[model samples]
Target chain A: MSLGGDWYLALAAIVFSIGAFGLLVRRNIIVMFMCVELMLNAANLTFVTFSRMLNDIGGQSLVFFVLVVAAAEVVVGLGIIVAVHRRRAGATADDLHILKG
Target chain B: MTHLVGPLVATTFVDALTFTVAAAIVLAGAVGVVVARNPVHSALMLVMTLFGVAVLFVEQQADFLAAVQVIVYAGAIIVLFLFVIMLLGVDRREVFGRENLRGQRPMAAILVVLGLAGIFLLGFGAHWATGAPSVAGRANAAGPNVAKLGTSVFTTYLLPFEATAALLVIAVVGAVVLVRRTPGARGPDDQDDAGLEEHPGADGGDGTLAFGTGGEASGDADDGDGGERGDLGHDDPALGSTHERKMTS
Candidate 1:
């Protein structure tokens, strides 16, 4: 059987789902950030697969900017997580109950 | 079968084999990231997953993306994860049963399962992606994955290119604003004179204020406070008091 482009897309979908599942279940802020990075990678895979299938370079082009945005996002997100963890006694997800109301 | 096998068949065999191996690694590492107890171990597992995805990208002819994947995600981001883990002392196994929200785990499982179903419907059960998005002729004129991407980004996507640059600067400045301590910041020791009455919001006020003077406090801690331990808790008065008690004992 020929390996069609759809196989790559399906793999990306599975990875994306795994990332989503991790994001939903995990409590640690850092782990959540890793999950997000995982999701982004899956989306990048989809984009590149479509790029190859369509013989277009634009999807690959979008992946470049997505990488930039992801780097900036990680910088800002980790800063927040670090700040919150430092302010509280424990870094558990439960410790962020200031907005419990 | 052997007589009919040609170069084309061999090429397809290699592609399928590579895809199978890479996909297996990616999925296994992703599952490990979810199930691993130690945050550092999970981070390492995430590195494995990223590397696998990079391999897939290379296979798909996104060579530049594969390089960037290794450099940016595996190189820089994983280092940041390890750094935060070391700084917070959260490298050890974490307690998983200590969820803050009620039914958080169950609800998460349900939502994630639904999300998976949705993705399946889109991926396997749909025909939407049969057509690839059309590209402008001028955009594909540069040739090759890397060069064509460069031309398309600098020309057709120039507006977004400049926009994300601004977004990156904002994110950098925001991170600095969030984490960087101010000069001449107050310390918990200084608040002893004022007392908790004056600053009823002293805990938060002190937490941040303590970080302001954290540079000095950290220096002091490094000078054999608990024999060089408890330096990270230098900014928290609660932890600092506990350290004092520990020292006395």
Candidate 2:
């Protein structure tokens, strides 16, 4: 089967947009984090698709770095979440307006 | 004969169908993250979404990204979220608030639609078809998956790699320091003291004052007595005479 076309790329883009919507509109912090992951995965999907389409190793290499950044993001973001939870007892992202200035 | 080829073709078709189903599940879970009310439940749904995406990645021949997505995103990060949820003793009722801003949700929906339209237009409508060599040639020629990634990361991208490590170290140190209570930090210790007082007669080694009125009086007595023995019980109505006996004896 011939692979790497615009259809799957469009689908990934739409999914990523939904995720961005969730990240924007959602008040819950953890769900927002999940949404962020969704967006990242969408980008990764595009990268892999294009990598296959072009037969370039660079896009795949970039996917590796993106994965690395995503891991680091999870580590740091969850650490912040835990810190906020410990300090506030329950870290609702809505409650994160302590520094709203 | 042709009958044997039919079974093999059927198996491959079934595998494709299975992969499609997995992809659908991942998409649904992404939607669930947006729609779910309970943050904990949403986080759990996100784990399913991540798993589905990993399957899709595997289907796309991105084995490394798939494993990293599952292991790092689903296993470690989501578990950290669950741990925080449990540790903070978050009640379900406390998480949801019924306050939709004026026209915010609809506006957000509209913006998302527009952004997606833009991306689709750019992705599909744009006439930029630059075909390079086919994947088969590269896959046959390179023959080293992890080694290629490692070489690029170490040699060409080494500076950024080390910088990322520094960033991670800083993040770890910052989170640790943020969560850690200093020796004299009053808030966390005060809460712990309140918890200690909840279980009356428990051996709180630091002699934390009890919570209520009698304990307040005891605290005052201890503060005034200039470092005497049995100071915590000195002002208690029950222990007053016993302390006096000890002082006289």
Candidate 3:
């Protein structure tokens, strides 16, 4: 296939879907976090690809914000995970369900 | 040779190499997260995966995003995860092994296959427009990258930017409260018994009595008359003292 705008966008979409699949199917929370990162990076790829295709800078600009969001997310999410581990003494998500039902 | 390897071949090679490396890293880390017996190892693998994806971002020319990916995802965030793991003391003894996959694996596999197929179909079918209106050249493509980002962050997207700050504050507060000990918290002994799974040979040779009748054997050796018998010696009795005379401590 040619490396056209559509093709690039399609590649990004496929990668994003794969990440989403991993996120849904994986039981491990840390794996889920990795999958989430994959999904975000996929979106960033789409942004950059479109930026190059359309010769625009806005899509690229949005990517920076996305990066910031990802960072903030990691900080808070990892904090929660740490808190959970402290309370439970292990980092398994299965242990978390015990508190619910 | 150089003529034979045209820009197309070169570009294709770069793309393929990038994709292969990125995919392998991601998949390996994902598998590690599931298969690794140690949760700490799994978390580290997750960091590796994040780093891999960041590299892919760089390949795609998302420079700003790549930097964020490294600093926020791999650097600061993974360190936070490490901190939590350390505070919990989850190593050697407390790691939970992988749960056996009874019926979940097959269904998960099927779903993944279907998802991939759907993505392929979407890609092949969509009629994507090529020439969209150019928004800007590429965000922060000039000198002072951070300044460009800062200007855009505060100028057009200030509202969302402020909201992000608020979210960060909440996360900080949440972490502090979650890990904070109470003013009258009990000593280490009084702390709740958590994640104390039975592991063989955890405390090796700590001078504690072993589980057996060995104590009876030693008790018989230290009879009441043994003390008086030692008094008969003219010397300090240190010369004739055997290895058993030394305390385990």
Which is the better candidate, 2 or 3, if ranked by DockQ? 2
Q: Candidate 3 regions off by >4 Å?
A: A1-28, B1-35, B91-102, B128-132, B135-151, B182-249
Candidate numbers sorted by DockQ from highest down? 1, 2, 3
Task: For residues B43-106, write the lDDT of model 2, one tens digit per residue.
Answer: 8878888888777667666667677888887888788877655443342332334444667677
Instruction: Give the distance in Å from residue A16's predicted Cα in candidate 2 to where it truly belongs.
Output: 1.1
Instruction: Identify the runs in model 2 with alpha carbons over 4 angstroms from their true place.
Output: B1-19, B91-97, B127-140, B183-249
Candidate 3 DockQ, CA atoms? 0.24
Summarize candidate 1's per-residue lDDT along B92-158 as a digit string, tens digits. Answer: 3456765657898888888877887887666555566456456533333546667777778888888
lDDT of 1 at B160: 97
TM-score of each: 0.76, 0.72, 0.63
- Candidate 1 — which pairs collide? none
**Which ten residues in a row are the worst by lDDT in model 2 chain A?**
A1-10
DockQ of 1: 0.48
Instruction: Give per-residue CA lDDT, model 3, range A19-80, as digits (tens).
Output: 67666656556556656876777677777766655555666678877776777677677667
Model 2 per-residue lDDT at B78:
83
Which predicted model would earn the best lDDT?
Answer: 1
Candidate 3 C-alpha lDDT tens digits along B22-139 = 7678667656654564557867877776777676666655567678878876777677666544443333222223444555656766787787787667656764656654444444
